[model samples]
Target: MLRSHDKCVVYIKSDDGEKVVDEIKTFQDAHWVSSPKALWRIYEFNLTEMQPAIINLQLHLPGKQAVCYWKKQNLQSIVESDFVHQTMLTEYFKMCPIDIEARTYLY
Candidate 1:
């Protein structure tokens, strides 16, 4: 089990339904906010002014990233050119899909 210093609960599920793990105190050791520029754009949208909208947005972001790969559309370049298009893309490839079975047999 892992726990955050702030006492936030984190859960991890395995591909097989056999393992259900609970995480207890952890630290924000990594910078999840990959692009500061993108975050700044969100701030520019004045989310603080719209409390409900901001809350809803935060809730949906993680699920959106999981099924979508936004990294393929070359977001870094796009953001560099236009600071406004910083929102995560829904149709782009965020990560390369891996074949677990193939990897297991390799070594």
Candidate 2:
């Protein structure tokens, strides 16, 4: 039977022979305690947040890209909206020439 306050014992062998060490054995502590990033996550803190935000590029043939529209919305109005024609890929291509920094990134 184990006592209420008793900790798990670990045995280590050295030149002096085997030595018993009392410890609160846990896989979580062993894996996460030594890492700063893991400790930050243990405290439930956000490690990284996108600054400018990321853009997901969409691929499609000309005039075949998907568009967002409500069921009640007219098909003609949906086709007329300027946003329907604009995708991340199109915007990236449009901005690449104008913005010098954009040229550094590969599509």
Candidate 3:
């Protein structure tokens, strides 16, 4: 289990969001949003535990990158971006999918 200090927000987008959300639900301490988009979902998990989660995403959603996003930074940007109901995460996520995943994995 991930410690409190490791808590972070995760935005998972797959060709199959429902399946991904279902898969994520099996993870410890994961909480999904009440509503889900057709091909994307938002969740929160501990930083350390997320590796396996990403691995699972790769296994199940092959060829898709599992991106990890920082809640506070993006949250600030989300608030500053346009003032919507946290949809900025999804929009920005879609805009820069490679970036979110690359930096997290490479750096």
Candidate 4:
């Protein structure tokens, strides 16, 4: 389903499932990350925090969107670069957005 959108999908499992999903959406709504390199940096930096339950990681190009899913608790987290650090919780949810348009545009 996510693959059809042409956006990067990275799913992650967190201590709190609902909170993580909300956080991801917040970041996506803001329109973050200008390039793919920045997105990769965010993923490498945050990988440690998202461990164990975070079984699957999907990264779609063009859109620079990531969807992170958990294997154990069925938790999902999405992160994009557009989100600003308005609060502590929001700050922690920061991520890079996949450039979906770029992929489709080229294809």
* CA-lDDT, candidates in order: 0.40, 0.68, 0.41, 0.41
Model 4 local distance difference test score: 0.41
C-alpha positional error of residue 53 in candidate 2 after TM-score superposition, expressed in Å: 3.5
> Can you write out model 1's per-residue Cα lDDT over 38-85, one digit (the tens) per residue?
677777865337533332222235233223236667755644553343
- TM-score for candidate 3: 0.15
Give the least accurate 10-residue stretch of model 3, judged by summed lDDT: 55-64
What TM-score does candidate 2 get on C-alpha atoms?
0.49
Error of 4 at 9 (Å): 3.2
- Report the lDDT tens digits of candidate 4 across residue range 1-106: 1232224444555887742445466447543455664776777766236433333333244344443445664332223223311332332233223554433321
Error of 2 at 71 (Å): 1.5
Per-residue alpha-carbon lDDT of model 2 for 1-107, expressed as tens digits?
Answer: 12222222335556778664434543222323346766778998776766555656788888889888889999998899888899878888899989999997666
- Candidate 3 yields a Cα-based lDDT of 0.41
Which portions of model 3 miss their true places by more than 4 Å?
A: 1-81, 85-88, 97-107
Steric clashes per prediction: 13, 0, 0, 27
- For candidate 4, the per-residue lDDT at 17 reads 70
The reply for model 2, stretches above 4 Å from the true place, is 1-48
Query: What's the TM-score of every candidate structure?
Result: 0.17, 0.49, 0.15, 0.16
Pick the TM-score winner.
Answer: 2
Clashes (candidate 1) = 13
* After superposition, candidate 4 runs with Cα above 4 Å error: 16-19, 23-107
